[model samples]
Target: MNILITNDDGVYADGIFELANKVKAIANVYVVAPDSEKSAIGHAITIHNPLMVKKVNFRNTDIDAYAVSGTPADCVKLGIEAILEDIHIDLVLSGINNGPNLGTDVIYSGTVSGAMEGLVQNKPSIAISYDGKNISSKEYEKGAEYVVQFIDKIKDNLTMLDDTMININIPDIRDTKINGFKVTQLGIRRYENTFEKRIDPRGNIYYWLGGKTVELEQDENSDVTAIKNGFIAITPLKYDLTHYDRIGRIMKEIQPLDI
Candidate 1:
């Protein structure tokens, strides 16, 4: 299998490197990622500015790697459209991210957004994250190892023809023991005091983002709840944002404009 690996945590981060290394043992791997951390950037693409790509060594790893001067999604774009244009990309794997990307967190997660880019191009993708206070290289390795095994299973059996994305979040390795993987749905995870007002030395007021968690009710089958229960959360995400059930009611309320 030909795989493209990327991350929002930058090209030199342990998580991306570990993931690439682990996947390399199973298939042809290519790495293209942002040069600096681009976390919480969502599914943004770099268009106005010129994107720069540089071939670099991934700490003596043999896989072909590049650092892009753009967002995490841009890396996948360049990989498919330019860098490996001729290669048949079987999958795009986007991250063993430093933190959990569960629930509504996926909406703002560049890690998940990176993989979303692949789905846009009709390629299957996976976004993996570690739910730890401080993610170590060991944690990254564990995520990579588990994902590698999962892919192996899919490769041997699943004959999927649809473009889809899988979001996976592994629980913290310390304190809590992993129960196993569970398919889940996205849940609510919003932050209270999302902004903090502050004054600069020059007395200019500025508001800094203070995205601290504000706990809300979540279903037992939610990805957020699964990670909290020591299980690896796997959710199949869709790109369509339409609420089909509300469409008819909305149309009936205002379709034949009277103005």
Candidate 2:
């Protein structure tokens, strides 16, 4: 299997490095990630600016890697559109992200967006993430190991029709045993957006975007709830934002007259 890997945490991030090291044994791995952290960058592409790509070495890991000066989505786009057009990429795995992509967190996750890009092009993909920032590099080794074990079971059976891209979040507790996996839905993450006003040396007013206070509602099958309860959360997400269930009801309220 030919697997294309990328992440939002840049080329040097331990999470991506651990992921690559583990998956290399399962397939031909290619790493094309951002040159620097591009967190919360959504699904953006570098259409107006020139994008750059440079080869990078992951000290101990003998794998093909590249650093891209672009958003996470752009890396995957460029990987397929330009970099590996000749190579038959069977799967695109994004992240083992530094932080969790739970709930509607997927909307702002560059990690999930990277995988979404591959799924958009009809390729099988998966996005992996760690729930807590306190998780050590050694902990990621365990998470990636589990990912390899999980992939080995599903890789050959995974068709484009069966599973496209799913967001997977692992808990951060080093000794906490995983209860198992849950097929979850996206949870609602309540946000308190605050912009802190500041003055630069040039005496210009600037605002720094602040972190959100995350609160998950009690939904048993939600990704947030699953992660909070010590199970690995696996959510099958789609790029289509259409609210199909509401379309019929909305159409009935808007009557069209013959003109």
Candidate 3:
């Protein structure tokens, strides 16, 4: 299989490196990622500014890699349209991210957004993240190993889909301690936003953004709860944001006559 990989943690992050090496054993891997970290960038693309691309040898891995000077979405877009147009890319994979993209975190995750872009283009895609434990660094060998195992499990079905995407979150723990995988739903994972006021040497006051993770009490099927209980969370996602269940019932309550 031909797999295209990208991540928000830059082309040199250990998570992406580990993932590339591990997945290469089963597929032809091509990585196009930001030259530097672009965390929490969401689904942004570099339309106004020109994107710079450079070929680089992935350390300890003989996979094809490109460092892009843009967002994670930009890397995937450029990879498909400009770089690998001649090659048949069967799957678009993102992450093995440095942090967990759980629940509402996906709303601000470039890792998920990278895979989302591929899904938007009707390609089979999956976004994988390792629970970061609030720490910025991660040892992704075990997580990467699990991801390869996941690929082996689902590799046959990748070519059979056109409009679906999957999100995988691995716990930040020892491999042997991991319980198993759970198909989960989005949980009420949120953040308590804060800003700290401070004065610099120039006597100017400024506020820096800060927040703490907050997970609301949810059912056991929630992704947050699954990870908390030591299971890898797998969520099937779609690009449609419509509240379809409410539309018909809501329309019945009001009459519209060019009002």
Candidate 4:
């Protein structure tokens, strides 16, 4: 299969590189990613400035790679729109991200957005993340195995045509004693203090994002709860933001009486 791999953690990130190498053995893998880490950039695209892509080599790997001057979502857009237009892209895999993209974190995650870009083009995409930021290359090997296994099953099944792309967050636990996989919904993962302001040289101001203290108050069958309970969380997210169920009620309450 022609699989295109990209990440928000840049081209040379340990998780991305490790994932690329592992998947190369199973399928045709092509890597196109940001020149540097663009974490939490959301689904931003470069419009005013021209985006550039350059071929680069990793430390010891001979993978076909490109470093793009854009966000993670921009990388996928460029890959589909301009880079590999003639090539038929079968699957788009985003990350082996350094941190878990669980719950509402997907909103600000470049990792999930990269894959979302692929889905926008009617292509199958997968967004994978490691639960911990300190995940090692060895731990990514396990994620790599799981990715291949997951795709293999889907390729064999081919029953669900309406299935949306997935947001998969795998735990960094190396014990392999996982609570298995669960198709979950998005959970609430909000930070108490999202940013911390500080002064730089010349007394210039700057801000740093604080860590998230995940909450599961109103949600039990959610990605956060699944991960917290030792399960590999798979939340099938879509690009559609419409509230179809509440449309009639909202229209009845807000519509003008002119008609």
Q: What is the C-alpha local distance difference test score of each model?
A: 0.90, 0.86, 0.87, 0.86
List the candidate numbers ranked by lDDT, top first.
1, 3, 2, 4
Candidate 2: minimum summed lDDT over ten consecutive residues — where?
155-164
Candidate 4 local lDDT, 58-168, one digit each (tens)? 666787799999998889989888888888888889999998998878999999999999888778888999987678888998888888777876865433423478899
For candidate 1, the 10 contiguous residues with the lowest summed lDDT are 155-164
On residues 109-160, what C-alpha lDDT tens digit does candidate 2 reach at each position? 9999999998987788899999876767788898998788778767768784
lDDT string, candidate 1, 156-227, tens digits: 543362556899998888867988889899988987867779999999999988768888999999999999
| Candidate 2 wrong stretches, greater than 4 Å | 160-163, 201-203, 257-259
The runs of at least 3 residues in candidate 3 whose Cα sits more than 4 Å from the true structure, single-residue gaps closed, are: 134-138, 249-259
Model 4 segments more than 4 A misplaced:
157-163, 199-206, 257-259
Total clashes for model 4? 0
10-118 in candidate 3: lDDT tens per residue?
A: 9998888888888888889999999999999999998899999999989956788999999989998999999888988888989978878998889899999999999
Evaluated at residue 231, the lDDT of candidate 2 is 87
Candidate 3, after superposition: displacement of residue 158 in Å? 1.8
In the order shown, what is each candidate's alpha-carbon RMSD?
Answer: 1.4, 1.9, 2.2, 2.2
Model 4 quality (TM-score): 0.91
What's the lDDT for candidate 4? Answer: 0.86
The per-candidate count of clashes, in order, stands at 0, 0, 0, 0
